[model samples]
Target: MFGSLGLPELLILLAIVVLIFGVNKLPKLGKGLGEGIRNFKSSVRTEEKTASDENGQDATKDANNT
Candidate 1:
């Protein structure tokens, strides 16, 4: 999606963000956004792991029953 945005467009976007949020709050906003993304990524990974584990256990149970 961002493949079409050139440097100038990115700079303009950054300028708009800075104008809207101001420089002082940018760091806090960035930190919160980062933490949110991190948490989301970790949760997704954990969910995928649990799903795979469950599938593996079901397969094993089926094999043993047979």
Candidate 2:
């Protein structure tokens, strides 16, 4: 439901976007948005992997100390 935006609100937003950008540009816009989201997800995953590796080392150190 997009937080506060319902289905009707989404339809209105879509109509406004179509009016502003036209139907022809929608495909390219969608493609660019998809690529941006994909890249962001990949970078976040890489960061999580690095953080987990550091955490694993810390855990090993703590175990040895005990």
Give the alpha carbon lDDT tens digit for every residue of 1-66 in model 1: 999999999999999999999999999999999999999999999999999999999999999999
Q: Candidate 2, residues 1-66: lDDT per residue as tens digits? A: 479998899999999999999999999999999999999999999999999999999999999999
Candidate models: Cα lDDT each: 1.00, 0.98
> What's the residue-level lDDT of 19 in candidate 2?
99
lDDT of 2: 0.98
Quote model 1's TM-score.
0.96
Instruction: Name the candidate that leads on lDDT.
Output: 1
Clashing residue pairs in candidate 2 are: none
